[model samples]
Target: MGWLTMTRMAMGGHETPKAYLDAQLTYERKAEGDTPFQGLRVLKSVYSGSTYYAAAERYDENGKRIYVTAIICLVRWNPRASDGHIFGYKDMDEDMGPCEASCPRSVLALLTTTSHPFALDWRRRCYRMLALRERRIADGDLIRFPEPMKFTDGSEHREFRIRRDGQKTVLTLADGRGRFKISRLLERRFEIVREPKVAKTFFPAA
Candidate 1:
Protein backbone atom coordinates (compact mmCIF):
# COMPACT_ATOMS: atom_id res chain seq x y z
CA MET A 1 0.00 0.00 0.00
CA GLY A 2 2.90 2.29 -0.76
CA TRP A 3 3.31 2.95 -4.45
CA LEU A 4 2.57 6.58 -5.39
CA THR A 5 4.88 8.17 -7.89
CA MET A 6 3.97 11.65 -9.19
CA THR A 7 6.94 13.77 -10.13
CA ARG A 8 6.52 16.70 -12.50
CA MET A 9 8.37 19.77 -11.38
CA ALA A 10 7.92 22.91 -13.47
CA MET A 11 4.94 24.45 -11.78
CA GLY A 12 6.93 27.45 -10.62
CA GLY A 13 3.48 28.89 -11.14
CA HIS A 14 2.78 27.35 -7.75
CA GLU A 15 -0.12 25.09 -6.57
CA THR A 16 0.81 21.61 -5.50
CA PRO A 17 -1.43 19.07 -3.93
CA LYS A 18 0.11 17.15 -6.72
CA ALA A 19 -0.82 20.05 -8.90
CA TYR A 20 -4.25 20.26 -7.40
CA LEU A 21 -4.94 16.65 -8.26
CA ASP A 22 -3.68 17.43 -11.73
CA ALA A 23 -6.38 20.01 -12.09
CA GLN A 24 -9.07 19.58 -14.77
CA LEU A 25 -12.19 18.04 -13.29
CA THR A 26 -15.54 18.90 -14.78
CA TYR A 27 -18.97 17.26 -15.28
CA GLU A 28 -20.38 18.41 -11.97
CA ARG A 29 -24.04 17.43 -11.35
CA LYS A 30 -25.95 14.38 -10.18
CA ALA A 31 -28.41 12.60 -7.81
CA GLU A 32 -31.87 10.99 -8.37
CA GLY A 33 -31.47 9.78 -11.92
CA ASP A 34 -27.70 9.57 -11.56
CA THR A 35 -25.26 7.52 -13.57
CA PRO A 36 -21.65 8.73 -14.15
CA PHE A 37 -19.49 11.35 -15.90
CA GLN A 38 -21.66 13.87 -14.11
CA GLY A 39 -23.83 13.61 -17.21
CA LEU A 40 -21.26 13.43 -19.98
CA ARG A 41 -19.23 16.23 -21.69
CA VAL A 42 -16.89 18.11 -19.39
CA LEU A 43 -13.98 15.74 -19.76
CA LYS A 44 -10.67 17.38 -20.56
CA SER A 45 -7.06 16.13 -20.44
CA VAL A 46 -5.72 14.16 -23.31
CA TYR A 47 -2.49 15.70 -22.12
CA SER A 48 -2.07 18.56 -19.64
CA GLY A 49 0.09 17.91 -16.55
CA SER A 50 -0.58 18.07 -12.78
CA THR A 51 -3.28 15.37 -13.09
CA TYR A 52 -4.40 13.08 -10.29
CA TYR A 53 -8.03 11.93 -10.33
CA ALA A 54 -9.94 9.06 -8.73
CA ALA A 55 -13.52 7.76 -9.18
CA ALA A 56 -15.99 5.18 -7.80
CA GLU A 57 -19.05 6.10 -5.79
CA ARG A 58 -21.81 3.95 -4.31
CA TYR A 59 -23.78 4.69 -1.17
CA ASP A 60 -26.50 2.75 0.63
CA GLU A 61 -27.44 1.08 3.90
CA ASN A 62 -30.19 3.68 4.01
CA GLY A 63 -28.08 6.50 2.68
CA LYS A 64 -29.70 5.99 -0.72
CA ARG A 65 -28.37 7.35 -4.05
CA ILE A 66 -26.16 5.01 -6.05
CA TYR A 67 -24.09 5.09 -9.26
CA VAL A 68 -20.94 7.12 -10.00
CA THR A 69 -17.81 6.18 -11.94
CA ALA A 70 -14.40 7.73 -12.65
CA ILE A 71 -10.68 7.11 -12.49
CA ILE A 72 -8.96 9.57 -14.82
CA CYS A 73 -5.23 9.07 -14.18
CA LEU A 74 -2.14 11.20 -14.86
CA VAL A 75 -0.49 11.96 -11.53
CA ARG A 76 3.02 11.47 -12.83
CA TRP A 77 2.26 11.07 -16.46
CA ASN A 78 5.33 13.02 -17.47
CA PRO A 79 6.41 11.77 -20.85
CA ARG A 80 9.31 14.19 -20.40
CA ALA A 81 6.71 16.82 -19.60
CA SER A 82 4.68 18.66 -22.25
CA ASP A 83 1.25 17.78 -20.94
CA GLY A 84 1.75 14.13 -21.91
CA HIS A 85 -0.12 12.66 -18.96
CA ILE A 86 -2.89 10.53 -17.41
CA PHE A 87 -2.76 7.90 -14.63
CA GLY A 88 -5.97 6.20 -13.24
CA TYR A 89 -9.83 5.89 -13.87
CA LYS A 90 -13.40 4.14 -13.13
CA ASP A 91 -17.06 2.95 -14.08
CA MET A 92 -20.21 0.80 -13.38
CA ASP A 93 -23.17 -0.89 -15.16
CA GLU A 94 -25.47 1.63 -13.61
CA ASP A 95 -26.01 -1.38 -11.43
CA MET A 96 -27.16 0.48 -8.26
CA GLY A 97 -25.99 -1.32 -5.08
CA PRO A 98 -25.65 -4.53 -2.99
CA CYS A 99 -23.96 -6.25 -5.88
CA GLU A 100 -21.02 -4.86 -3.90
CA ALA A 101 -19.70 -1.44 -4.88
CA SER A 102 -16.50 0.30 -3.76
CA CYS A 103 -13.28 0.55 -5.70
CA PRO A 104 -11.98 4.07 -5.15
CA ARG A 105 -8.35 3.53 -3.97
CA SER A 106 -8.31 6.76 -1.96
CA VAL A 107 -10.81 9.41 -1.02
CA LEU A 108 -10.17 11.50 2.06
CA ALA A 109 -12.69 14.01 0.83
CA LEU A 110 -10.72 13.55 -2.35
CA LEU A 111 -7.53 14.34 -0.46
CA THR A 112 -8.11 17.87 0.69
CA THR A 113 -4.84 19.37 -0.58
CA THR A 114 -2.85 16.30 0.47
CA SER A 115 -1.35 17.28 3.81
CA HIS A 116 -2.56 14.01 5.29
CA PRO A 117 -4.68 13.59 8.42
CA PHE A 118 -7.92 15.16 9.55
CA ALA A 119 -9.33 11.70 9.26
CA LEU A 120 -8.79 9.89 5.99
CA ASP A 121 -8.46 6.16 5.83
CA TRP A 122 -9.74 5.74 2.29
CA ARG A 123 -8.86 2.57 0.39
CA ARG A 124 -11.86 1.02 -1.37
CA ARG A 125 -10.54 -2.21 -2.81
CA CYS A 126 -13.52 -3.98 -4.45
CA TYR A 127 -17.27 -3.63 -4.95
CA ARG A 128 -19.26 -2.73 -8.10
CA MET A 129 -21.45 -5.03 -10.04
CA LEU A 130 -24.72 -5.45 -11.95
CA ALA A 131 -24.41 -9.11 -12.31
CA LEU A 132 -21.26 -8.03 -14.22
CA ARG A 133 -20.80 -10.68 -16.84
CA GLU A 134 -19.61 -9.33 -20.21
CA ARG A 135 -16.20 -8.29 -21.62
CA ARG A 136 -14.16 -6.35 -24.25
CA ILE A 137 -13.48 -2.63 -24.75
CA ALA A 138 -11.18 -0.31 -26.65
CA ASP A 139 -10.62 3.16 -28.13
CA GLY A 140 -7.92 4.86 -26.11
CA ASP A 141 -9.21 3.15 -22.99
CA LEU A 142 -8.50 4.11 -19.34
CA ILE A 143 -11.78 3.47 -17.49
CA ARG A 144 -13.58 4.61 -14.31
CA PHE A 145 -16.13 7.44 -14.23
CA PRO A 146 -18.28 6.53 -11.25
CA GLU A 147 -18.78 9.47 -8.85
CA PRO A 148 -21.88 11.11 -10.20
CA MET A 149 -23.97 11.21 -7.04
CA LYS A 150 -26.04 14.09 -5.66
CA PHE A 151 -28.76 15.12 -3.17
CA THR A 152 -30.28 18.39 -2.00
CA ASP A 153 -33.75 18.29 -0.52
CA GLY A 154 -33.41 21.93 -1.42
CA SER A 155 -32.33 22.31 -5.07
CA GLU A 156 -32.45 19.02 -6.98
CA HIS A 157 -29.70 16.84 -8.47
CA ARG A 158 -29.68 13.57 -10.41
CA GLU A 159 -28.00 12.79 -13.70
CA PHE A 160 -26.14 9.94 -15.43
CA ARG A 161 -24.03 8.86 -18.45
CA ILE A 162 -20.54 7.38 -18.68
CA ARG A 163 -21.29 4.61 -21.16
CA ARG A 164 -18.56 3.06 -23.30
CA ASP A 165 -17.64 0.16 -25.64
CA GLY A 166 -15.60 0.80 -28.72
CA GLN A 167 -12.29 1.22 -30.72
CA LYS A 168 -10.88 -1.99 -29.11
CA THR A 169 -8.45 -2.85 -26.29
CA VAL A 170 -10.79 -4.77 -23.97
CA LEU A 171 -12.61 -3.54 -20.84
CA THR A 172 -16.17 -4.53 -21.44
CA LEU A 173 -18.78 -5.02 -18.74
CA ALA A 174 -21.45 -6.75 -20.75
CA ASP A 175 -21.02 -6.76 -24.48
CA GLY A 176 -20.83 -10.45 -24.43
CA ARG A 177 -21.51 -10.57 -20.70
CA GLY A 178 -19.87 -7.72 -18.77
CA ARG A 179 -16.14 -7.90 -18.01
CA PHE A 180 -13.55 -5.92 -16.05
CA LYS A 181 -9.88 -4.80 -15.84
CA ILE A 182 -8.60 -1.24 -15.56
CA SER A 183 -5.69 -1.14 -13.15
CA ARG A 184 -1.96 -1.52 -13.69
CA LEU A 185 -0.45 1.76 -12.58
CA LEU A 186 -1.55 2.85 -16.05
CA GLU A 187 1.81 2.82 -17.87
CA ARG A 188 0.02 2.62 -21.18
CA ARG A 189 -2.26 -0.07 -22.55
CA PHE A 190 -5.83 0.35 -21.31
CA GLU A 191 -9.19 -0.95 -22.52
CA ILE A 192 -12.12 -1.58 -20.20
CA VAL A 193 -15.75 -0.51 -20.71
CA ARG A 194 -18.88 -0.52 -18.55
CA GLU A 195 -21.18 2.49 -18.51
CA PRO A 196 -24.29 1.37 -20.30
CA LYS A 197 -26.89 1.44 -17.57
CA VAL A 198 -28.38 4.91 -17.86
CA ALA A 199 -30.20 5.10 -14.51
CA LYS A 200 -33.19 2.86 -13.72
CA THR A 201 -32.10 0.63 -10.88
CA PHE A 202 -32.33 2.59 -7.66
CA PHE A 203 -32.17 -0.06 -4.90
CA PRO A 204 -34.23 -2.75 -3.24
CA ALA A 205 -31.86 -5.67 -3.28
CA ALA A 206 -28.98 -4.35 -5.45
Candidate 2:
Protein backbone atom coordinates (compact mmCIF):
# COMPACT_ATOMS: atom_id res chain seq x y z
CA MET A 1 0.00 0.00 0.00
CA GLY A 2 1.02 3.62 -0.51
CA TRP A 3 2.26 5.83 2.36
CA LEU A 4 -1.01 7.71 2.72
CA THR A 5 -3.07 4.49 2.72
CA MET A 6 -0.74 2.85 5.27
CA THR A 7 -0.92 5.89 7.48
CA ARG A 8 -4.70 5.89 7.46
CA MET A 9 -4.85 2.20 8.23
CA ALA A 10 -2.42 2.43 11.12
CA MET A 11 -4.35 5.28 12.72
CA GLY A 12 -7.67 3.43 12.95
CA GLY A 13 -8.07 1.20 9.90
CA HIS A 14 -11.26 1.51 7.84
CA GLU A 15 -13.74 0.44 10.52
CA THR A 16 -12.62 2.71 13.39
CA PRO A 17 -13.09 6.48 13.06
CA LYS A 18 -9.99 8.68 13.31
CA ALA A 19 -11.73 11.14 15.62
CA TYR A 20 -12.75 8.37 18.00
CA LEU A 21 -9.18 7.04 18.12
CA ASP A 22 -7.87 10.49 18.87
CA ALA A 23 -10.39 10.96 21.68
CA GLN A 24 -9.53 7.63 23.16
CA LEU A 25 -5.82 8.45 23.08
CA THR A 26 -6.45 11.75 24.80
CA TYR A 27 -8.49 10.10 27.53
CA GLU A 28 -5.79 7.49 28.11
CA ARG A 29 -3.13 10.14 28.42
CA LYS A 30 -5.20 12.09 30.90
CA ALA A 31 -5.80 8.97 32.96
CA GLU A 32 -2.06 8.42 33.06
CA GLY A 33 -1.45 11.96 34.36
CA ASP A 34 0.37 12.91 31.17
CA THR A 35 -1.06 16.37 30.87
CA PRO A 36 1.02 19.17 29.44
CA PHE A 37 3.82 20.38 31.72
CA GLN A 38 3.57 17.30 33.85
CA GLY A 39 7.19 17.31 35.12
CA LEU A 40 7.96 21.01 34.81
CA ARG A 41 9.67 22.75 37.74
CA VAL A 42 8.33 26.11 38.89
CA LEU A 43 9.74 28.67 41.31
CA LYS A 44 7.67 30.48 43.92
CA SER A 45 8.66 33.88 45.21
CA VAL A 46 8.66 34.15 49.00
CA TYR A 47 5.74 35.96 50.66
CA SER A 48 6.94 39.30 52.02
CA GLY A 49 3.90 41.53 52.23
CA SER A 50 2.67 40.99 55.81
CA THR A 51 3.20 38.93 58.90
CA TYR A 52 0.54 36.29 59.54
CA TYR A 53 -0.99 36.44 62.95
CA ALA A 54 -2.90 33.79 64.96
CA ALA A 55 -4.31 34.23 68.43
CA ALA A 56 -5.16 31.70 71.12
CA GLU A 57 -7.42 32.71 73.96
CA ARG A 58 -6.45 31.54 77.39
CA TYR A 59 -6.75 32.43 81.06
CA ASP A 60 -3.71 33.43 83.06
CA GLU A 61 -2.87 32.39 86.63
CA ASN A 62 -5.30 35.01 87.85
CA GLY A 63 -8.07 33.68 85.59
CA LYS A 64 -7.88 36.75 83.36
CA ARG A 65 -8.64 36.28 79.71
CA ILE A 66 -5.62 37.02 77.55
CA TYR A 67 -5.17 36.44 73.83
CA VAL A 68 -1.78 35.12 72.87
CA THR A 69 -0.81 36.10 69.36
CA ALA A 70 1.37 33.95 67.19
CA ILE A 71 3.23 35.53 64.35
CA ILE A 72 3.68 32.98 61.57
CA CYS A 73 5.76 33.03 58.43
CA LEU A 74 4.33 30.86 55.69
CA VAL A 75 6.31 29.76 52.67
CA ARG A 76 4.17 28.25 49.95
CA TRP A 77 4.98 26.38 46.71
CA ASN A 78 2.61 26.81 43.82
CA PRO A 79 3.00 24.98 40.52
CA ARG A 80 1.92 26.54 37.26
CA ALA A 81 1.59 25.59 33.61
CA SER A 82 4.23 28.07 32.48
CA ASP A 83 8.01 28.04 33.01
CA GLY A 84 8.26 30.00 36.29
CA HIS A 85 6.53 29.76 39.68
CA ILE A 86 4.03 32.20 41.18
CA PHE A 87 3.78 33.43 44.76
CA GLY A 88 1.03 35.54 46.28
CA TYR A 89 -0.39 36.56 49.62
CA LYS A 90 -2.53 34.03 51.46
CA ASP A 91 -4.80 34.67 54.40
CA MET A 92 -3.29 34.01 57.81
CA ASP A 93 -6.10 31.69 58.74
CA GLU A 94 -6.08 29.83 55.46
CA ASP A 95 -5.43 26.14 55.79
CA MET A 96 -2.15 25.56 54.03
CA GLY A 97 -1.72 21.87 53.47
CA PRO A 98 1.45 20.07 54.40
CA CYS A 99 3.58 20.95 51.41
CA GLU A 100 6.40 18.73 52.52
CA ALA A 101 4.18 15.77 51.76
CA SER A 102 2.57 17.13 48.62
CA CYS A 103 5.09 19.48 47.05
CA PRO A 104 8.68 19.34 48.14
CA ARG A 105 9.14 23.09 47.56
CA SER A 106 6.41 24.30 49.91
CA VAL A 107 6.91 24.88 53.65
CA LEU A 108 5.11 26.52 56.58
CA ALA A 109 7.16 28.01 59.41
CA LEU A 110 5.44 29.17 62.58
CA LEU A 111 6.87 31.75 64.92
CA THR A 112 5.28 33.32 67.96
CA THR A 113 5.01 37.02 68.74
CA THR A 114 6.49 36.23 72.12
CA SER A 115 8.06 33.07 73.49
CA HIS A 116 5.07 31.32 74.98
CA PRO A 117 5.91 28.97 77.79
CA PHE A 118 3.88 26.16 76.23
CA ALA A 119 5.87 25.84 72.99
CA LEU A 120 9.14 27.65 73.71
CA ASP A 121 11.38 24.62 73.78
CA TRP A 122 9.67 23.09 70.78
CA ARG A 123 10.15 26.27 68.75
CA ARG A 124 13.78 26.48 69.78
CA ARG A 125 14.41 22.93 68.66
CA CYS A 126 12.78 23.59 65.31
CA TYR A 127 14.89 26.72 64.89
CA ARG A 128 18.05 24.79 65.58
CA MET A 129 17.17 22.27 62.90
CA LEU A 130 16.62 25.05 60.40
CA ALA A 131 19.95 26.62 61.30
CA LEU A 132 21.86 23.39 60.95
CA ARG A 133 20.30 22.71 57.55
CA GLU A 134 20.65 26.28 56.31
CA ARG A 135 23.79 25.60 54.32
CA ARG A 136 21.97 23.07 52.16
CA ILE A 137 19.02 25.35 51.46
CA ALA A 138 18.81 27.86 48.61
CA ASP A 139 16.83 31.07 48.75
CA GLY A 140 13.75 29.40 47.27
CA ASP A 141 14.43 25.77 48.03
CA LEU A 142 12.21 23.75 50.38
CA ILE A 143 13.57 21.35 52.93
CA ARG A 144 11.52 18.36 53.97
CA PHE A 145 11.24 17.90 57.68
CA PRO A 146 11.99 14.38 58.78
CA GLU A 147 9.07 12.08 59.35
CA PRO A 148 7.05 12.35 62.59
CA MET A 149 7.27 16.14 62.47
CA LYS A 150 3.60 16.66 61.85
CA PHE A 151 1.58 18.36 64.61
CA THR A 152 -1.90 18.39 63.18
CA ASP A 153 -3.79 15.34 64.41
CA GLY A 154 -3.77 15.77 68.16
CA SER A 155 -3.85 12.03 68.66
CA GLU A 156 -0.88 11.36 66.39
CA HIS A 157 1.02 14.61 66.82
CA ARG A 158 4.12 14.59 68.97
CA GLU A 159 7.01 16.93 69.68
CA PHE A 160 10.27 16.29 67.81
CA ARG A 161 13.94 17.07 68.28
CA ILE A 162 16.50 17.04 65.45
CA ARG A 163 20.14 16.35 66.14
CA ARG A 164 23.30 15.89 64.11
CA ASP A 165 25.63 13.03 64.91
CA GLY A 166 28.81 12.74 62.86
CA GLN A 167 27.48 12.70 59.30
CA LYS A 168 23.92 11.70 60.05
CA THR A 169 20.95 13.62 61.43
CA VAL A 170 18.55 12.13 63.93
CA LEU A 171 14.91 12.95 64.55
CA THR A 172 13.52 12.12 67.97
CA LEU A 173 9.78 12.10 68.67
CA ALA A 174 8.41 12.19 72.17
CA ASP A 175 5.16 12.70 74.04
CA GLY A 176 4.34 14.69 77.17
CA ARG A 177 5.90 17.93 78.54
CA GLY A 178 9.50 16.91 79.06
CA ARG A 179 12.19 17.44 76.43
CA PHE A 180 14.14 14.44 75.10
CA LYS A 181 12.99 12.19 77.88
CA ILE A 182 12.52 8.54 76.85
CA SER A 183 9.75 7.28 79.08
CA ARG A 184 6.26 5.84 78.87
CA LEU A 185 5.26 9.17 77.43
CA LEU A 186 7.85 8.73 74.72
CA GLU A 187 5.67 7.64 71.83
CA ARG A 188 8.33 6.78 69.27
CA ARG A 189 11.60 7.99 67.79
CA PHE A 190 13.61 7.32 64.66
CA GLU A 191 16.70 8.61 62.88
CA ILE A 192 17.27 9.98 59.38
CA VAL A 193 20.69 11.09 58.11
CA ARG A 194 20.12 11.70 54.42
CA GLU A 195 20.06 15.30 53.34
CA PRO A 196 16.88 16.44 51.63
CA LYS A 197 16.97 16.88 47.89
CA VAL A 198 16.88 20.54 46.90
CA ALA A 199 14.24 21.55 44.40
CA LYS A 200 15.29 23.34 41.19
CA THR A 201 14.26 26.96 40.69
CA PHE A 202 12.43 28.03 37.53
CA PHE A 203 12.20 31.73 38.45
CA PRO A 204 12.99 34.22 35.73
CA ALA A 205 15.96 36.49 36.25
CA ALA A 206 15.55 40.25 36.58
Candidate 3:
Protein backbone atom coordinates (compact mmCIF):
# COMPACT_ATOMS: atom_id res chain seq x y z
CA MET A 1 0.00 0.00 0.00
CA GLY A 2 1.06 3.55 -0.66
CA TRP A 3 1.72 6.12 2.03
CA LEU A 4 -1.51 7.90 1.12
CA THR A 5 -3.50 4.75 1.77
CA MET A 6 -1.66 4.13 5.00
CA THR A 7 -2.38 7.72 6.00
CA ARG A 8 -6.06 7.21 5.28
CA MET A 9 -6.07 4.03 7.35
CA ALA A 10 -4.45 5.85 10.28
CA MET A 11 -6.37 9.09 9.93
CA GLY A 12 -8.43 10.38 12.87
CA GLY A 13 -10.31 13.48 13.97
CA HIS A 14 -8.69 16.60 15.59
CA GLU A 15 -5.85 16.66 13.05
CA THR A 16 -5.88 17.51 9.41
CA PRO A 17 -5.17 14.55 7.11
CA LYS A 18 -1.90 16.19 6.09
CA ALA A 19 -0.81 16.52 9.70
CA TYR A 20 -1.58 12.91 10.38
CA LEU A 21 0.39 11.87 7.31
CA ASP A 22 3.39 13.86 8.43
CA ALA A 23 3.33 12.35 11.89
CA GLN A 24 3.10 8.83 10.52
CA LEU A 25 6.07 9.47 8.23
CA THR A 26 8.12 10.82 11.10
CA TYR A 27 7.29 7.77 13.18
CA GLU A 28 8.24 5.45 10.34
CA ARG A 29 11.55 7.24 9.88
CA LYS A 30 12.41 6.88 13.56
CA ALA A 31 11.42 3.21 13.48
CA GLU A 32 13.93 2.40 10.71
CA GLY A 33 16.78 2.00 13.15
CA ASP A 34 15.11 -0.89 14.94
CA THR A 35 13.03 -2.22 12.02
CA PRO A 36 14.65 -1.80 8.66
CA PHE A 37 12.40 -1.33 5.65
CA GLN A 38 13.59 -4.55 3.97
CA GLY A 39 12.20 -6.71 6.73
CA LEU A 40 9.02 -4.78 7.48
CA ARG A 41 5.56 -5.82 6.43
CA VAL A 42 2.29 -4.02 7.07
CA LEU A 43 -1.07 -5.72 7.37
CA LYS A 44 -4.37 -3.95 7.92
CA SER A 45 -7.67 -5.02 9.36
CA VAL A 46 -11.09 -3.62 8.55
CA TYR A 47 -11.41 0.15 8.71
CA SER A 48 -14.62 1.77 9.89
CA GLY A 49 -14.63 5.51 10.08
CA SER A 50 -11.61 6.34 12.22
CA THR A 51 -11.11 2.95 13.83
CA TYR A 52 -8.88 0.24 12.37
CA TYR A 53 -6.06 -2.25 12.96
CA ALA A 54 -2.48 -1.91 11.68
CA ALA A 55 0.20 -4.52 12.14
CA ALA A 56 3.93 -4.52 11.39
CA GLU A 57 6.15 -7.56 11.07
CA ARG A 58 9.91 -7.90 11.05
CA TYR A 59 11.66 -10.70 9.26
CA ASP A 60 15.19 -11.91 9.81
CA GLU A 61 17.83 -12.23 7.09
CA ASN A 62 16.71 -15.78 6.38
CA GLY A 63 13.07 -14.64 5.85
CA LYS A 64 11.86 -15.91 9.20
CA ARG A 65 9.38 -13.73 11.00
CA ILE A 66 11.18 -12.38 14.05
CA TYR A 67 8.67 -9.99 15.56
CA VAL A 68 5.10 -8.84 15.11
CA THR A 69 3.30 -5.82 16.58
CA ALA A 70 -0.19 -4.51 16.10
CA ILE A 71 -2.10 -1.37 16.98
CA ILE A 72 -5.79 -0.67 17.23
CA CYS A 73 -6.60 3.00 16.73
CA LEU A 74 -9.97 3.97 18.18
CA VAL A 75 -11.30 7.47 17.60
CA ARG A 76 -14.28 8.65 19.57
CA TRP A 77 -16.40 11.33 17.95
CA ASN A 78 -18.04 13.89 20.21
CA PRO A 79 -20.01 16.79 18.87
CA ARG A 80 -19.69 18.62 22.17
CA ALA A 81 -15.92 18.39 21.94
CA SER A 82 -13.92 20.24 19.34
CA ASP A 83 -12.13 17.13 18.12
CA GLY A 84 -12.48 13.45 18.77
CA HIS A 85 -10.04 11.64 21.02
CA ILE A 86 -7.62 9.12 19.50
CA PHE A 87 -6.42 6.07 21.46
CA GLY A 88 -3.98 3.29 20.59
CA TYR A 89 -2.78 0.03 22.10
CA LYS A 90 0.53 -1.80 21.70
CA ASP A 91 -0.21 -4.45 24.31
CA MET A 92 -2.89 -6.75 22.98
CA ASP A 93 -3.27 -10.47 22.40
CA GLU A 94 -4.44 -12.25 19.32
CA ASP A 95 -8.05 -13.51 19.55
CA MET A 96 -8.48 -11.21 22.56
CA GLY A 97 -9.37 -8.43 20.09
CA PRO A 98 -8.71 -7.08 16.64
CA CYS A 99 -5.13 -6.39 17.78
CA GLU A 100 -2.18 -8.78 17.52
CA ALA A 101 -0.07 -10.24 20.29
CA SER A 102 2.98 -8.08 19.65
CA CYS A 103 2.83 -4.53 21.02
CA PRO A 104 5.34 -1.81 20.16
CA ARG A 105 5.51 1.43 22.14
CA SER A 106 6.30 3.47 19.04
CA VAL A 107 3.06 2.38 17.40
CA LEU A 108 1.01 3.39 20.42
CA ALA A 109 2.65 6.80 20.62
CA LEU A 110 1.51 7.57 17.09
CA LEU A 111 -2.03 8.17 18.25
CA THR A 112 -1.49 9.42 21.80
CA THR A 113 -0.39 12.85 22.95
CA THR A 114 0.52 13.54 26.57
CA SER A 115 -0.53 17.18 26.29
CA HIS A 116 -4.23 16.30 26.12
CA PRO A 117 -5.33 14.61 29.31
CA PHE A 118 -8.91 14.18 28.18
CA ALA A 119 -7.84 12.48 24.97
CA LEU A 120 -5.37 10.33 26.83
CA ASP A 121 -8.07 9.15 29.21
CA TRP A 122 -10.42 8.47 26.37
CA ARG A 123 -7.83 6.26 24.67
CA ARG A 124 -7.16 4.32 27.84
CA ARG A 125 -10.82 3.52 28.48
CA CYS A 126 -11.44 2.45 24.94
CA TYR A 127 -8.36 0.23 24.91
CA ARG A 128 -9.50 -1.57 28.06
CA MET A 129 -13.02 -2.05 26.73
CA LEU A 130 -11.79 -3.56 23.45
CA ALA A 131 -9.33 -5.82 25.20
CA LEU A 132 -12.10 -7.18 27.40
CA ARG A 133 -14.44 -7.66 24.47
CA GLU A 134 -11.74 -9.52 22.56
CA ARG A 135 -11.29 -12.00 25.37
CA ARG A 136 -15.02 -12.60 25.62
CA ILE A 137 -15.33 -13.26 21.92
CA ALA A 138 -12.43 -15.69 21.91
CA ASP A 139 -14.11 -17.73 24.65
CA GLY A 140 -17.02 -18.58 22.35
CA ASP A 141 -19.21 -15.83 23.71
CA LEU A 142 -21.40 -13.93 21.29
CA ILE A 143 -20.92 -10.17 21.66
CA ARG A 144 -23.80 -8.01 20.61
CA PHE A 145 -24.81 -4.78 22.28
CA PRO A 146 -28.56 -4.48 22.60
CA GLU A 147 -28.32 -0.78 23.27
CA PRO A 148 -26.01 1.98 22.17
CA MET A 149 -23.22 2.34 24.72
CA LYS A 150 -21.55 5.58 25.74
CA PHE A 151 -17.75 5.67 25.72
CA THR A 152 -15.61 8.05 27.70
CA ASP A 153 -17.97 11.01 28.00
CA GLY A 154 -18.49 11.04 24.27
CA SER A 155 -21.91 11.94 22.96
CA GLU A 156 -22.00 8.99 20.61
CA HIS A 157 -22.55 5.33 21.38
CA ARG A 158 -20.55 2.77 19.42
CA GLU A 159 -20.87 -0.87 18.36
CA PHE A 160 -18.24 -3.24 16.94
CA ARG A 161 -18.39 -6.45 14.94
CA ILE A 162 -15.92 -9.00 13.60
CA ARG A 163 -16.30 -10.70 10.25
CA ARG A 164 -14.23 -13.58 8.98
CA ASP A 165 -13.63 -14.04 5.27
CA GLY A 166 -11.73 -17.23 4.56
CA GLN A 167 -8.44 -16.60 6.38
CA LYS A 168 -8.91 -12.87 6.69
CA THR A 169 -10.69 -11.13 9.56
CA VAL A 170 -12.35 -7.77 9.22
CA LEU A 171 -13.48 -5.58 12.13
CA THR A 172 -16.55 -3.44 11.71
CA LEU A 173 -17.61 -0.41 13.74
CA ALA A 174 -21.04 1.18 13.83
CA ASP A 175 -22.20 4.42 15.35
CA GLY A 176 -25.33 3.69 17.33
CA ARG A 177 -25.93 7.20 18.63
CA GLY A 178 -27.81 8.25 15.46
CA ARG A 179 -27.19 10.10 12.21
CA PHE A 180 -23.58 8.95 12.09
CA LYS A 181 -22.65 6.96 9.01
CA ILE A 182 -19.84 4.47 9.02
CA SER A 183 -17.35 4.75 6.23
CA ARG A 184 -16.75 1.95 3.74
CA LEU A 185 -14.14 -0.56 4.78
CA LEU A 186 -10.79 -0.62 2.99
CA GLU A 187 -8.05 -3.14 3.66
CA ARG A 188 -4.58 -3.48 2.20
CA ARG A 189 -1.22 -5.13 2.79
CA PHE A 190 2.20 -3.89 1.71
CA GLU A 191 5.83 -4.84 2.01
CA ILE A 192 8.41 -2.16 2.70
CA VAL A 193 11.16 -2.52 0.12
CA ARG A 194 14.53 -1.80 1.68
CA GLU A 195 16.70 0.81 0.08
CA PRO A 196 20.46 0.38 0.21
CA LYS A 197 21.09 4.06 0.99
CA VAL A 198 18.52 4.02 3.75
CA ALA A 199 20.03 0.91 5.26
CA LYS A 200 23.50 2.48 5.15
CA THR A 201 22.25 5.51 7.03
CA PHE A 202 20.72 3.34 9.73
CA PHE A 203 23.82 1.16 10.13
CA PRO A 204 26.76 3.31 9.17
CA ALA A 205 29.26 1.09 11.02
CA ALA A 206 28.15 -1.95 9.00
lDDT of each: 0.33, 0.32, 0.39
The candidate that wins on lDDT is: 3
Model 3 alpha-carbon drift over 4 Å, by segment: 1-37, 72-127, 131-206
lDDT of 3 at 132: 43
List CA RMSD, all candidates.
Answer: 21.9, 24.8, 23.0
Report the C-alpha lDDT of model 2 over 25-111, residue by residue, as the tens digit: 221111245533212111121323332223222334343444333223333333341433222223322123211111112222422
Off by over 4 Å in 2: 1-70, 73-115, 134-206
> Which candidate leads the pack in TM-score?
3
Q: Estimate the TM-score of every prediction.
A: 0.20, 0.19, 0.25
Using TM-score as the measure, name the better of candidate 2 and candidate 3: 3
For 6-114, candidate 1 gives per-residue lDDT tens digits of: 3334333424433334343323355555543233221222222433334434344443435333434433443354443322222122122212223333432332222
Q: Which is the winner by lDDT between candidate 2 and candidate 3?
A: 3
Give the C-alpha lDDT of model 2: 0.32
Ranked by lDDT from best down, the candidates are 3, 1, 2
Per-residue lDDT, model 1, residue 97, is 22
By TM-score, the candidates rank as 3, 1, 2
By summed lDDT, which 10 consecutive residues of candidate 1 come out lowest? 118-127
